[model samples]
Target: MIRRTFPILGVLTAVLLSYGLYEALIGAPTEQSMGDVQRIFYYHAPSAWTAFLLFGINFVASVVYLIQRSIKADIIALVTAEVGVVFCTVVLVTGPIWARPVWGIWWTWDIRLTSTLVLWLIYVSYLILRRFSSSGQTPLMAAVIAIFGALDVPLVYFSIRFFRTQHPQPVIGGEGSIDPKMLQVALINWAGFLCFACLVCWSRYRLELLQREVEETEALEALLDSRKAQ
Candidate 1:
């Protein structure tokens, strides 16, 4: 069932992403203030939402791994963390670009910006721990880090609400509101980005599982050879 669906999903995702690009660029009306520069918001906001979602899944998977010591759960945690970092990186990069023209600065040490940078650092550290640690307990350690890192995600999200920040207010829920057409385009772009993230996560999970299988097979062969030598 999943195998059949993968191709269809790929095609659909491609269509959605292309249409979303068109909508973001040409279809969406120019902003009264920022003008075309505001178009970057379509990409920037969706990337953040996608990163938050991936990290949330990573946190859940990490918790499950800690409770059950399940290899599947550990793999999930690793893959999600890996992908989440990528989207998080996009957020960090795009934010500075948007900020430079608007705030007349490339970066700021505001609560929202700082918390987000910390969030990115935490996940990068999580990935590093998983990659470099040779201990068999690496998964457990990584899981613990993931749980800790997830704590920062909420802080990053609510920083603007709780503190004064240079970042713009939320369009959906805060004091500011978006144009109806802009909102529609943003939603469309977000849907495309979500689909893209799902596709990437699924592929990464499968590849990780395969690599594990190969590693186990090699270990088994080496053990058998040693026994025969004895």
Candidate 2:
């Protein structure tokens, strides 16, 4: 089942990405103020949205893991956190690239930027704790971290509104509205990225499940060997 759907997902992601790239790069009109530089917003905004969305998933899975101690829930929380980190990486990279020409600097310590950086760091730390540390208590600790990490997503989203920042205002319901064509492009790219994220998360979750199976098999074999020797 996975083998058949996996290749199909990859192909679909490629098609979506190619079309999205063309729409963002050529179809979308240039902004009156920032000009071509504003085009980076196509990828930047979607990546941010995707990251937040994944983190939300991670939060729910984390809660389920805590309450039920289900391995499926734990796998989901782990995969979502890892995928969310990838999206956050895109946001952090593209943000500075966009800011360089607009703000005359590559980075800033504004509320929006700071909170987002912290969000990324928290998830990165969560991944390290799960991957590099010892087992058993790690999932519990990681689940707690994921729950708290997700709490920061809302703060990052509202930081621009709650505090003064060099970052641009929201594309929706802010002081100014987005151009229709640009909004369409943004939405299109967002859809593509979300699909891409799902593909990646599914692959990671399956891989982790396989890894656990292998580990359990090895442990069982070792136990049998020890009993035979005894």
The per-model lDDT (C-alpha) reads 0.86, 0.86
The digit string of per-residue lDDT tens for model 2 on 112-174 reads 677778888999999998987687787898999888777766777676556554555432212
Clashes of 2: 0
Return the TM-score for each candidate structure: 0.91, 0.88
Residue runs of model 1 more than 4 Å from their true location after superposition: 152-175
TM value for model 2? 0.88
Residue 169 Cα positional deviation in candidate 1, in Å, after optimal superposition: 14
lDDT of 1: 0.86
What TM-score should be assigned to candidate 1?
A: 0.91
lDDT of 1 by residue, 89-178 (tens): 999999889888877788866666777788889999999998899858889999999887777667676765565545554322232778
